[model samples]
Target chain A: MSDKPIALDAMGGDHAPHEVVAGAVHAVRERGLSVVLVGPPRVLYEALEDHRATKEVPIVRADEALAMDEGALASLRRPRSSIAIACHLVRQGNASAAVSAGSTAGIVATGRLRLKGLPGVLRPAIAVALPTLPKPTLLLDAGANADAKPEMLVQFAHLGAAYAETAFSIGKPRVGLLTIGGEAEKGNKLTRRAHELLTASPALHFVGNVEGHDLLTGLADVIVTDGFTGNVALKTMEGAVQYAFTELRNTVNAHRAARLGALMQRGALRDLQRRLDSEAHGGAVLLGLTGTVVIAHGSSRAAGISAACQLAADLEKGGVVTRIGERVASTHRTHRLW
Target chain B: MSDKPIALDAMGGDHAPHEVVAGAVHAVRERGLSVVLVGPPRVLYEALEDHRATKEVPIVRADEALAMDEGALASLRRPRSSIAIACHLVRQGNASAAVSAGSTAGIVATGRLRLKGLPGVLRPAIAVALPTLPKPTLLLDAGANADAKPEMLVQFAHLGAAYAETAFSIGKPRVGLLTIGGEAEKGNKLTRRAHELLTASPALHFVGNVEGHDLLTGLADVIVTDGFTGNVALKTMEGAVQYAFTELRNTVNAHRAARLGALMQRGALRDLQRRLDSEAHGGAVLLGLTGTVVIAHGSSRAAGISAACQLAADLEKGGVVTRIGERVASTHRTHRLW
Candidate 1:
C-alpha cells in the first residue's frame, strides 16, 4: 500500500535466511508490504527459491553477517553486518525501517553506530509491548542500558511515551515509574531519584511509582524502569506465562472431563494463547535512534519475523523516529541533561 | 491431632479480629490444630461472640495492639503487642509457633526482638513458597533485608535450603542464586560476588545463577536473592497471574461460543486457580529465627489465616527453628562472618 520499503536483516535470527525470506514473502504477498531482504545474496536467493518466492521478494547483497554469539563491539567493527547494512538502508532513504532478530546488544549498538541517535537524545532505550489488560502496556529499557542515570531514565520515559502514542495510538499515555512499592520513597536510591525526575517532566503523564503487580493491571499505559529491574520483571512475567500454560496443558489432560473441557474450549484457549504470545506483538524497538530499528526474538520463526516487519513498517508510517527526536529536542531545550 | 498449639495474632491483618478469629475457629474445628487467639480479650471476645464461636475458640489476653502504620520501633515500645505476645508464647514454650497477618516489618521486628534471631545468624530472612511446577520453589529474603551483602545472600541460600528440606520434605534442595541471568557473570556486582560465595558454601546445593524465567520452571528447589529483587519478582509474577486470569475471563465472556466453552472448561479452570493460588501454600516464613514465625497476607481471609496456622504448626513439628539454628551455627563455625 505504502511506497516505503522495510529493510529485513535476512542473515539475523535463529532461522536466518530461510524463515526470514519466507516471512518477507508472506509480508509482501499477504500484508501487501514492500521489503528488501538484506543478507548474503546467494543464501537469501536460495532461501527465497525454496519458498518459490525469489521473484516476489528482492534481496539486497550484504557479504557479512553478525553471528548471534557476537557482542556489541562486533556491530561497530562489522559495518557490513546484516543488521548494520539494513540500518544503513534506512539512513540512506533506500528503506523506511530496519528489522532484525539478532542479539539485542548488536541491534542497539549497530542502530546507534550506523543510524546514530536522535538529536538531543541522551541514550537509546529498548521498548517492549507487554500484553497487559485493556491493552498492551509499553515497558521501556527492557535491557538496553543496565546502569542508567536518573536523567537517562527520564529520557527513557519521554521515548516510551512517544512510542506508545505513535504505535498504540495511546494519547497522552500515563507513565509510571517501576519500583518495589507504590510509595514515593520505597525503592532504592535510583528509583527515588527517578521518581522525582519523572514527576517533574511536563512532557510525561507521570502517574507516580508503580509496583511490579501494576505492570499487567493497566495501572499505567507506559511503565518506565532502569534496565536492570525492567529486564528482570519482563523475563519473570514471560517465564510465569510459559509455566502457567504448561500447567494448564497438564491440568487439561489430567482427567477425562478436563480433556473434554479442553476440546470445547479450544477456540477460546487459542485466542488466549495468541494474546499472550510474545511473537504476536513483534519485538522490542530500539528507540531514540535516528531510524526505526526493531529487534525480534532470537528464536523467532517466520511468523515472528513477519510480525516484526509489520511492526517496523507501522513504526515507520507512524513517524516514531521524528516524534522521538522532537520530544528529546524539546526536553533538552527545557532541561538539558547531556 | 497435634498437641502443640499456635499463637494467632488476632488483632492483625486488614480484617483484624473478625477474619483472624474466624480463621482460628476454622483451624481448630477443621484441621484439628490447637490455637490460642492473642489480642485484646474484650474486643476479640465480642468478635467471637458475634460468630457464636466464643466457646469453640479460646482467647489469650493481650492489652496492647501494634498498629499496621507502626514500624520496627513499635515492636520495641509495644512489648505487650499481640504479635510480640504471640512470639513470647513460643519463646516460653507455651505455643510451638506464632502466626501473624500483620505488617511484615512489625512481625519481623517483633520476632527478632522478642524471640531473637538464631545463634550466629546475622539477620532473619523471609522465605516465600512459589507455586512452581513439579514442586513448589522456595524464594528467600522476600522482604526482610532490602540491601543484603554477598554474605547475607549466601546465608539466605542456607536458610531457604533448610526450609525447603524440612517444610517441603526435599533432601539436599538445589539452591540457585536469583539474578538477572542464568550465567555466572550476568548480574549486578552483588550477584557476581554472591555466586562465588554460594558456590563455595558447603551447606547448600549451589546450582549457579538462575534468572527470573527460572522461578516458575522449578529450575531449582530453593531460589535465593536479596529481599528487594525477590519481593519485586514474587509480586510481579503474582500480578501477571492475576492479569492473565482477568484477561481470560474477558476473552471467555466476549461471545456465546466462548461463554459455552468457559462452562465446559470450568473444572479445569478451577483446578488451575487452586494450583496458582498463593494463599493455599500459607504465608511466608521468616527464616533464621530462634522461633518459627509465619507472616500471612495483610488482607488474608479466613482460609488463608487457617492455612498459615497449619503451616506454622507443620514447621514447628518439623523442628524448623532447631534446623535453622544448626545451619547458622555451622555457617558461623566455617566462615566466622559474625
Candidate 2:
C-alpha cells in the first residue's frame, strides 16, 4: 500500500461529511489508502462514528468551511476553509495530494491561490477523462479560465499530453485542437492561431483540428481548447447523455418485450452505464499546480468520492505534477513562445 | 391534398438526381405533395425514368447546377443554378416554396440574394428543430452569418419565435438566448448585450440565457444564438448523438443477453432513433426570407428530401413568410435598430 496521504475536504459536496466520511472509510479499508479529513471536527466525528470508523480515519480540524456558493474571492477571504486547508496540507507536505468534491470554480481558484503553480507554467488547466470508444480521451480546460490566448491553448495541449501519458499510460499521445471543422482554417481567430502554434510546437504530437464528433471516437488522446468552448462541449455531452439515457429508460419500460430485453441485457447495460459514468473516472484534475488536486463532482456519492481519492493517489504515484513541470520547463527552454 | 407546388433542387445533395427524383416521387405518391424538379431536364428525366415515375413527377428545365463544393460567392456568380432557379420559381409564383439538399451556405446566400428578406428584416436566420425531450426545440441562426452583433441576435430571436409559433404551433413560444449559463450576465460580450436587448424587446418572449444542456431538455421553445455559436452547438449536438448511438450499438452487441434485449426492444429503440434523427425533422429552414426556403442536409436521402418538401409545403400553407414579414415590419416600425 502507498504511504502517501490525501487531504480530503469533508465539508464539501452535496452529501457533505456523511458520504465524504463513508467514502474515506471505504478508501482506507478497501483501497488501503490513507486520508486526512479537513473540516469541522464535531460534524466529521459524528459522520465517522456513523460508519463506525472513528479510529480508522483521522480528522485535521479546519473550523472554517467554504460553501459551494462561494466564489473565487472566498479563497482569499477564508484562507483556512476546508478546501483551502486541504490545499495548504499538500503545500506544507502534510499530504501528498488534495481531493475535494466542491464547486469547480472554488476548487480551481483555491488550488491556484493556495498551492500556487509550478515554475514556467502560464496557467493551470482542468483535464477530464471522457469515456470514448476503445479508450478514454482526455479533454483539457474543461472549465478553468474562460478567456484564453492562443499561447495558453498551446500550453494546455502540453499539459494535456503529459496528463494522458502519465494517467492513462499512453505512449506519444496525439493532441488535437477542438474546432468547428477538420479543415486547417475552419475556426475562429483563436483556433486558427492555436492551430498554427500547435503545429509549430515540436514538444507536442499535434494532430490538426478535430470537430465535436471526434470527442468520443478516440481520434486523439489529448483534446485541447479554451475553457469556454471546452466547458460548453463537456456540459453539452453530459446533458445529451442524460437525455439519451432517460429516453432509453422510457423506451425500455414502454412494453413487455422491452422490459424483458432490458432485464436480459442488464449486465451489458450496467457495463455501458459504468463506462459512461463520470463519477467512475473521478472529477477533473486541475493541472500545472504545485501538487496534485482532484476535484470530484459536487453531487458525488460515496463511490464517486472513493474513486476520486483513488485517482488522486494514482496521480500522485504517477508523478503527474513533476512530469508536467518538467515538460513545460523543457518546452519553454527549447522553444520560446513570443 | 394541397394544390401548391414545391420547387425541388434535383441536382443538389450527395446522391443528387437519384435520391432527389425518388424523394419527389415519394412525396407525390406517399405524402400526396406536388413538386417541380429544378435541374437539367435530361438528367432529371433519366433519374425519373430509373425510378419508373417520369410521368408522376414534373421536371423544370434549369441549365446551371450548383456544385456542393461551391461557397457563398457562388450564389451571386451562378445566378441560374438549380437552387437559385428553385428560389426564383418561388418568387415568380410558379412554386409555393423551395426545398434543396444543397450547400447550406450557398442556399442561405442564394435565398437572401434571390428571394430576398422580408420587409424590415436585418438578415435571414437558419432555424433547426432539435429533438429534445417531450417535444422538439427550435434553434436559430444555425449558420446564416458567422459573426452577429447584439441587434442581429435580437432579430434572430424574433425570427425563431415566429418560426416556433407557426411551425411547432407553440403559443407565445418562450425564447431563450443560448449562452454559457442561465445568468443574465454570464456569457461573452455579444451574449451579454444580446440578453439585455432580448429582454427589452416586446416582440419576443425572452426567458434569459439558457445553457447548452437546456437545448435537449425543452427548457425554451425557441433558442436564439449568434450564427457561429448556434452552428457550433448544432454540429456538436449532432456529433454527440452519433457518438452516443455508436457507443450504444457496440455495448448492445458486446454480450449475448444484451443482444437478446436489443431484439425485444427494437421497436422502442427505433422510435428513439427516429426522434433523434436530424433528417426526420425535414432539415433546417432559412427563416425571415420573402419566400419559404428549406435547406435540407447535404447528405440527405430520398426520405429526407421528401420530408423537406413536405415541411416547405406545411410552412407555406401556414403563411410563415407572411407572418414573419408582419412581425419584423411591426417590430422595426416600433423599435428600429438602425
Candidate 3:
C-alpha cells in the first residue's frame, strides 16, 4: 500500500458531494490520509471550497452518477458513474481503495465489472462487522450473492475468516454456519452440505451450526450464510435496535423522573448507542475482489464517510485482498466440491 | 369447538409436570377453562397436589415422555409420548386443542403426524406473532419446513392470513412475501415464483415483497417465507432485543443518575418488556393443521404455560382450524402449481 490516495464517489450517498467532500477534508486534515473525490469537477470543487479543502484533496472527473434507487442495471446504463470511476482508479493502481455510499447493487455490479473477482474466487461477498462483546463478529455474503450454491457458501466462509483476521487481527478465527438449528444434520440442503464441507476443511476453524440468536453473542468470529439470509438477519438486527431505542425514548419522556434519570445518564446511553452503531463501523466491506471496497450507509454524513475511508485504508494497508486470494486458492484446491 | 378441555403436555418443557401442572390448575381455577394434564400418572398427581388443584384439572395417563432435546424423530421413537397423547385427545374430540411447552420440532412433528394437514396444506407451518406496533405481524414457517417449494410459500400466506383474521379480528389481511429486496423481481427463484402466484391470486391481499426491516414496522399483516429464513429472522429479532436490553441494563447500572431514572421508569420498562416478550404472546402456533395447537417456549414457566393454554383455547373457540381449511382449499384449487 504505497501512499496511494483512496478514491471516493463524491456523487454517491443521500447527502451527496457536500458531506462526502467534508469527509475527505477530515480524512486529509485530521487523519493525514490522501484522498481523491470522484464526481463532476464543478460540483466537487465548490463542495471542497465550502470546507476550504480545495488544495488538500484532488478531484477526478466522472460524468454520470448512479441514483440511490437504481439497481445493477444502472452500472451498465451509466458506464462512467461516480462509483465506476472510483473502481477504475483502484483497478488502474492510481488509488489504494474505492469507497462509496451508492446503491449497493450498483456498486457491487460496477465492482464486479471493473475491479473483477480475485483468482479462484467464486463471487464477491459483502462482509459486515456485528458489534458484539469482547470482539465484533464478521458476517459474510450480506447481500452480494442472494442465491448461492453450497460451494459459494464455503468460499464465503474463507472470505469472512480472512476478513476477520485482517480487520480484527484474530488468529485462527472460528467460523460458523448460520442456519435454523445448531446441528450438522439440520438446515436445508445447502447449509447441511456446507456444514459437512466446512467441518472437513482443515484450514477453517469451523464451529458447528449457529442459530440466528447467536449473531450478536460472539459465539463465532466469522459466520457464513447465503446472501439472502445474511441480508435479512443483518437488517432485522438494525430494525430491532432502532425499535428498542424508540420505545426507550417514549418511556423516558412519559415521566419527569425518568426524564431526569435519562438526562443524567445520557452520556452513558450515547456511549452504548455508539458501541452498537453500524455506520460507526464503516458499513459493509466487499471482499474477494482485486482491490478493497467499502460501501458506507446511504444516509451517511461526514463522520460515517470518514470512518468508511479509514476502514478502506486499513484493509488496503493490511493486504486483505491478497489474504483472501491466497486462502481461497489454497482451500478451494484441497476441498474441491466437484 | 365444544366444551372439551384443552390438552396440556405435562411431561414437556424444562419445568415439566410441575410448571405445566400449575399452569393447568390456573386455567381451570381462574380462567374457567377445562384442562387435562397428559403425562405419567404418578408425576402429574404429585404436581397437581402441590398446586392444590387435584380435582380442578383432570389427569390423562401417558407413560412415555419426549425429552426436551429430542427433535422430530422423537415423535416416532416415543409414539405414546405425552405430546403424542395430547394430540390423540384432540383427534378423538376429547380435547378442543393441544397446548405444549416442548421442543418445537417434536411438537411440529407430532402435530402433523397426529392432527394431520387440512385439505390442501402442503405442510404445517409455525406462525409466531411478532410484537410490532399497532398490531403484531404474523410470520410463518418459523422452523417447520427447512426447505419449501414456491407453492408451499403461497400456502403459508393463506395460513397466516387466516390466522390474522381469526386472532386479531383483521378482515382481509395484507400478505407480504419475505424476500431480500422490496421489488417483486428482486428475490431468488422460489420467492420470484411465489410473488407471481401471490399477485395472480384473487383470494390474497398481496402487497408485494418485504425486507427484514419491515418485520417490526407493521407494514404487512402477514409476512410469509420459507421455514429457514423465517426461523432465522425471528430468532435474530429476539437476539437483538435481548442484546439491546442487556446493554441498556449495564449502562444504567454504571451510573447513579441512570439508576434513578431506570428505577423511576421501571413500570414503563416492564410494560415494554411484556409487549416484546415472545412467551407473553403464547409462543408460536403450529398452523395449517386439522387441530389448533400452541407450542410454548421450551423454557416456559407457570405463567407462560398458562398463557399458552389460553391461546390454544382462544384459537379453538375462534374456529381458526376451519378458517384456515377454507382459505387453503379455495386458494390451492384456484392457484394450482401443478
- B1-338: candidate 3 lDDT, tens digit per residue: 57999999998988987888888888887888899999989888888888778888889999998888899997988879999999999998899999998888999999988997788788989999987767789998798998999989988988888888887888989999999898878988889999998898889999999998888899999999999999999889889888888788777666655445557456766677766875324659999888888998887778888888888888888889998888887876675655
Cα lDDT tens digits for candidate 1, A48-136 = 88888888888888999899887778897898988889999988888999999888878888988998778778888899988765577
- DockQ winner between 2 and 3, please give it: 3
For the predicted complex of model 1, DockQ is 0.57
lDDT score, candidate 2, position A29 = 94
For residues A15-111, what per-residue lDDT tens digits would candidate 2 score against the true structure? 8878888899999999999998999999999888888988989999899977888767777888889999999999988899999988877888999
Worst 10-residue lDDT window for candidate 1 chain B reads B255-264
Question: Which candidate has the top score in TM-score?
Answer: 3
Give the DockQ-based CAPRI class for model 2: medium
Taking the true A–B contacts (Cα pairs closer than 8 Å), what share appears in each candidate? 0.65, 0.42, 0.80
User: Which candidate tops lDDT?
Assistant: 3
**Per-residue lDDT for B120 in model 2?**
78
Judge candidate 2 at residue B177 and give its lDDT: 81
What DockQ does each prediction reach against the true complex? 0.57, 0.50, 0.75
In candidate 2, which residue ranges exceed 4 Å CA deviation? A1-4, A73-77, A255-271, A279-281, A334-338, B1-4, B30-32, B50-56, B67-79, B91-94, B112-122, B252-255, B258-266, B279-281, B330-338
Put down candidate 2 lDDT per residue, B42-151, tens digits, no spaces: 99998888888888888888899888888778889998899999999988888999999888878888898889777778888898988765557888888777667898
Q: What digit string (tens of lDDT, one per residue) describes model 3 on residues A1-338? A: 66999999998899997999999999888888899999999999998888888999999999899999999998988889999999999999999999999889899999999997799998999999888867789888898988899989889988888888877889999999999887789999999999888988888999899999999999999999999899999888888877887777677667555445547455766777766774423569999889988999898888889989988888888888889888988886785655
